[model samples]
Target: MSSETHEFKAEVAALLNLVTNSLYTNSEIFLRELISNAADALDKARFQALVDTSLDGQELESQILITVDKQAGTLTIEDTGIGMTREETAQNLGTIAHSGTLRYLEEMQRARAAGESSGAVEPNLIGQFGVGFYSAFMVADEVVVTTLSGKPGSEAVVWRSRGDGSYQVEPGSRSQRGTTIVLTLKTEAKEFLDRWRIEALVKRYSNYVMHPIRLRVIDEQGEDKDPEPRQINAASAIWARSSSELEDSDYTEFYKHVMGGFVMPGDEPFARLHFTADAPIQFHALLFVPGRAPADLFQEDRKALQLYARRVLVVENCDTLLPQYLRFVRGVVDSQDLPLNVSREMLQEHKSLAAIRRQLTRKTLKLLAELAEESADKYAKMWNEFGSVIKEGLHTDGGQRAELTELLRYRHVADTDDGLVSLKDYVAGMGEDQKYIWYVAGPNEAALRNSPHLEAVRAKGEDVLLMSDPVDEWVLQSLSEYEGKSFRSVTQGELDEPAEDEDIDDKDDDSDDKDDEAKAKDKREPSPIDPLLNLAKVVLGDRVRDVRASKRLTESPSCLVDAAGGLSRNMERILRMAQPGTKLGASPRILELNPDHPFVTAASKISETNKDDPRLAEWVEILHDIAALAEGTVPDPAGAAKRFTKVLNNLVAG
Candidate 1:
């Protein structure tokens, strides 16, 4: 029969340009696509043979054979499974049927322009778009495929492509069933003609492909020999194995193998979770929480788990398997049930995929909770290292907030120095009358523990959760309440509850009720210092949100707190510094003064004894600066220095 050349579909041309020109900088991944294709072909043949027993007892072993011809500068990957008839080869190779091609192309175009994620080929995208067959063009100048159908009397076919714009198909000479792809490596890509390079690429991308990947091994001798078959790929998927038959060391070794360079050498995994889901979706996962955080955990390229469709590695860094907060998790998600579009490159957005994600996240959080309970010291170390990342989910995922909240722990002044307490424990310890769960968030322990905002509550012997992580404030903002107790920032709002040892208990029966009188006295507003507050408010002007004598301040003269609905001072500072062009201006703060302090008493005297003393305005400004400094801010240090100089001069002159 006469051979004929056919033009590629327009979309196929675009897809070719993306792989060869933009994404295939390494070029070795072409082998992975070919091997994955071989695995797929074997799967089809195995299914057909099972249905029609007429094909039984043939050499039914499913394996992929690869050979390198150094002299010819070519690589051939041949599979022993279902081969295509001439008509089938022409039809499958000539057209693009995958619906996600346009979507994948749009994403790739954006990625290339942004210089993100464009460096590596996304295995699933290739499979989903059904363009993986054409990926060989990335490394080869010419590709030829020879195939014979596994069907009873179908003829062999040879498809040839220079991958410029056209391909040719004709009857082939192959006797047995299955397909063989031969690549005439480009001059620049001739490195793929080496046995070692082929082996390494197979191990990196397709080592776990279900079919044996047979490669001819070269020994130390310089002589060229006949092909002695050896399986290059493990051909066994780790997740497909039963948990009962596998040991921790087996899982550990598999994790290390899968993680490759992403995980640190010699570090252990914190935990491993293995399970299979039959309902909602059929999937098996071997998830591991790395013992040490990846050095690149904070980077945009943080590695994620591989996604496999039916043991054929489909997606690399399939982050949809877990949320960004759990990007540090390393493992495999193998599902025979995920409906991959033709070409197995792009997964259609199915309800089952979302359900799978929800299930995995729930199970992961449960595993962490179990670890925290069974091994507090170990989990604490993990929290100290990774809690910052976990807290991010609280701000981003509303549905998982409560689960994440329970999984979180924090160091507190209330707990022993290094120990942490959960919100549950703090709530359990709360007095029957306490209305909110109190917390103080800052940059570090020293800043938080030294904060004047915590003083009055500490004086009352009420505990406050000390949150030092920068993410803690944002997370608490998103997680407003847990189990009915609203989070109240000690640095933001007033505390109404009396001290734990205070006499509300004694007032149960009108027993002398000295505590009742004290409570009534404390309930009295800033009426005692109204004139002093008025004088300072006028002098400070818009510099302060409003001046008030604080019941929260006992040891310090003044402090700053957030407005009723506003973010905390520290949280604002963090936002302004971390984000550019934020227009955060200065956080509007209420300057609260300790009315009982000697300085305030002296300040009251100034308002009463010398209403026109210019020094009065100066001291009010000084108090504002001091509060700023105490709040860990450098608000006008030079101006504060000049003002302090004037204050010293006035004190001596007076």
Candidate 2:
């Protein structure tokens, strides 16, 4: 047949050049790319057959076939799936369909010019940009594609291309309605001709592709002795199997396949949930809490699950199936209920997918709860590795706050060992009069343990949770209360009133009903530390909202507290770091001084006798600086040092 020659589009040529030269560091991935395309073609055919019973490919077995000719230095991959005609072949293979191809080419060129060995673009972009087919050019000097459309009366076509700027398309003869690809391997790519290497690559990347991949290898003499091809893949959807029919090893193997590689090769999954839901929407899920988080767990676009439709792999790294906070999960979710032609845009608005997501999240949380109940040590270890991530859910998932709160574990002032206590345990251990669940957040456990805010709570023998993670402040804000007990940040609000002693419950109604005159009389009387508090407020001015005698502090001279509804010191620090050059300290905090402390008593005497003494102002400044230091930050390190030096000099002179 006469062939029509066509020059590739500029973007396609550039992409071909990049792929053949240095786009992928791992050359074996070309096989994976080809295999993935074949699987997708099969999926399309199966879905089409469902819609149109007369589709020509429906009679063919749904499978992929691989044949290697070592003597000829060529490899072939054939799929009994949907195929393209001459025009479709030319358009699909000769041009770039993605709009970002130009941008991608520019980025690659820049990276190459900068002496980068690999492209700067994400590896997945090759697939997303609709040029994954070109990856075959990376290993083969020449490639030939023979295809016949699944549509009735469609003509067969042949597309041939070398690692050059042009390709040729012509009429071809094929009785089957599918595509066949043959690659003339480059000298260096001959390693792919090895039967063992081909098997390994298939198992690594396409083991769970949902289509049987059959292999037939020719020996050095080019004679195939095997009568039939051997299936290389398990070919069964692991998630679709009944949970009772699967074992731990089966689950672990599937986890490795879904995660793309042997991540933490020595570690088993921390936990897994395998179940089928047939009620609201039929779906199967096999979710895993990885033994440890992937290295890119915190990356913004990192995806942790694979979405499938009718056992056909749809989205390879599907992020929409799980919340961002739960990106540590790894598994596959398959449902025939979803449209086989579902798009990412449609997945965003699809009510069925949303319901599936919600159910997956609840099931995951429930799995964790069960793990914690059945195995305490195991749960604690998982919490240690992943608690910070789970805390994010408390901040972002309001509907799951109660569940996430139950999942929370924290180190407290009473923890003798490095153990975490849950909120339930903390509440159960609370004193009868303890009105709030107290917590203190700081840079670390050491800093939080030394916090003056926790001094009174500790004095009362009530434990306060030590929160050190950056996300803890936001989490506490979202979880304002748990089990009817309001979460009170010790550093942000008034300290708890002293717990009343049950042995001393005698009181008279006359005293409770005292007249307004008696109340006024009580208000007029000033305590001994009132002078020190009043003087500090004046000297500090608006830097502090108010200066008051402490019901919280037992030993520290002074400490800062967020006003009625202002940012705590830890929260302000987080914001300042997150948004630089923004005004954030506009809201002043209250300064509370310990009434019975020696420094306050002596300072009160001096302020009462001589309110204008310059030394008293210096002492007040010193008090404020000390409070800031105790809060794990120095407002002005230089100023604080200078004042401290002056105080040291004055003391030396005296």
Candidate 3:
């Protein structure tokens, strides 16, 4: 056969450079990549025949065949796919010329410059990149492609490249209407010639590939005679199987596969939600909550979700299936109704995709809730590992806030140190006099459990929810109330028990004459320390929105609470940490002092004894820092250190 030679396109050289220079992490992915390309080509051919009868019913079985010649160091991959015409062969092979290919290339080029050649390319641009095909050149010294267009009366074309700077195209003698690629393998790639090795690679990456991948075997006794072709992959979609037929081990193994061999931290999935949907979208997802979160689960960067359209892989790790709050979920979501050529932008706005996400989120929450009820131990492990991540949903995904709230668990003042209680449990235990759910957020469990804000609540025999997670404050923003009871911060505002009607009447008859004298005394002499509230307010005017007598504090001297409609101390701290150079611009927190506390009483005497002493103002500043420190914050490290030493010295001297 006579052939014509053509110089390689400029982009082809750059693409070859990218591939050989390391566009992929595993070299063996070249085989997987090439096989995937063949399968996609076959898919297009099969789909075309659905509308064009002339192209169907006569072509070879829609299957992929791979043959290896060890001595010649060549391997051939053939597929009865919609083969390319001459122009397409040059365009697709010689240069990147599909939709979004330029953008994909530009992105890859940027990633390549940052030494991230393995960075992601958009899923929908898999074929558009025209780069997966070049991956074959990673192991091959030369590549030859012979293709016959599926169109009737079309002539065959063969494309050849030597992994060098030139390629050739010529009229070829081929009766079949498909594509055949022959790779002259490099000596280092001879391992691929082993039948078992090929089988293993097929199972690892292409087991779920929709079409059959058959390998031609050569018998040891006679290399000339070929053995019957054997199917090397499962070629069946795993998630589409009925739940009854699947076992826990099956789901575990599949999770490992989809998640790139990530063994869930506890060597088990926290839970698995496997179900098929045919309503809004024809899709099924096999999602697992890892028994423990990965080290990078909280990071913004991660692999995409294993997004699939039909049985073909769209992206290995797609972020669109569920929101970032659910990033710890590891699994695959396959949609049968999504178009093969769906773009990344299209996917983000896709109605089917949105529907799938909604359903998956619901199933995930439902699964977690059921696990909490049925398997407390498993649910505890999950909460210990990923509860903070789940809590992020309370602030991010408003639609799921109610469901997410139901799954929230926390340490309660009433429960044992290791125990957790849900909101429902807290509500169930509430007394009739309790009209609000109370909680306090601090830096950690120990701090919250011992918090001064909790003292008053405990006195009334009411439990206060202990919240230490950073996301807890945000959760409280929109979740102010549940089941008709408002969520109130224990340290904020004021608390008063309901007045007893019987006690009021019983005391009324005895108090008339005595009340007159008691009221006269109260008007003449307030608590000795009450004057300090006014004094501290004058000294720390704008530093605090208000200085008030304590309603909750018992053992502690002072504590701060957010003003109405203001950010909590914990929330402001988190936001400040997340955004550097961004001021909190906070209005002063309300500082309340316990007038009965020994420290306040003693400080008041010192101020009363030396009315003009500046030490009173210094005491106020020191109190603020101490209160801030108790709340797990540093108001002024240097100033606090100086004031702490001065106060300690003064007390020791006295």
Residue-level lDDT of model 1, residues 452-527, one tens digit each, is: 9888888877788888888888887687777788888887644564423334543555444345545544665656
Q: Write the per-residue lDDT of candidate 3 for residues 1-654, one digit (tens) a residue.
A: 467777776656775676665666567767876787787677667655765679833557989999977767788899998787787787778763342234434775796799866443323223444567777887899999999888887888999998777789999887788889999988899888888898888875677887899998554443833577878887888898999998878887788876667674556877888899989777878888876677778676776568766455656667888888888888888876664432222354557777888898888889988999998878888999989888988888898888898998988889865788889989999999887788888678888887778888888899999888878887887787789778877865546522211133334554553363344334443556766777898988888877767768878888886654356777777788788698766557878788878878877887777756788888888778877877777768998899999988988999
Error of 1 at 82 (Å): 4.4
Candidate 2 has its poorest 10 consecutive residues by lDDT at 497-506
Q: Cα RMSDs of all predictions?
A: 10.0, 12.1, 11.2
Candidate-wise lDDT, in order: 0.76, 0.78, 0.76
lDDT measured at residue 380 in model 2 versus the true structure, 0 to 100: 90
Q: What are the per-residue Cα lDDT tens digits for candidate 2 across 187-244?
A: 9999999989999888756676778999998988979945599999877877877888
Sort by TM-score, top down from the best: 1, 3, 2
605, model 3: CA deviation in Å?
A: 5.2
List the pairs of residues colliding in candidate 1: 124-345, 127-343, 127-344, 127-345, 128-344, 128-345, 128-346, 130-343
State the TM-score for model 1. Answer: 0.78
Query: For model 1, what is the C-alpha lDDT against the true structure?
Result: 0.76
TM-score of 3: 0.69
Instruction: Give TM-scores for every candidate, taking all chains together and pairing residue i with residue i.
Output: 0.78, 0.69, 0.69
lDDT-best of 2 and 3: 2
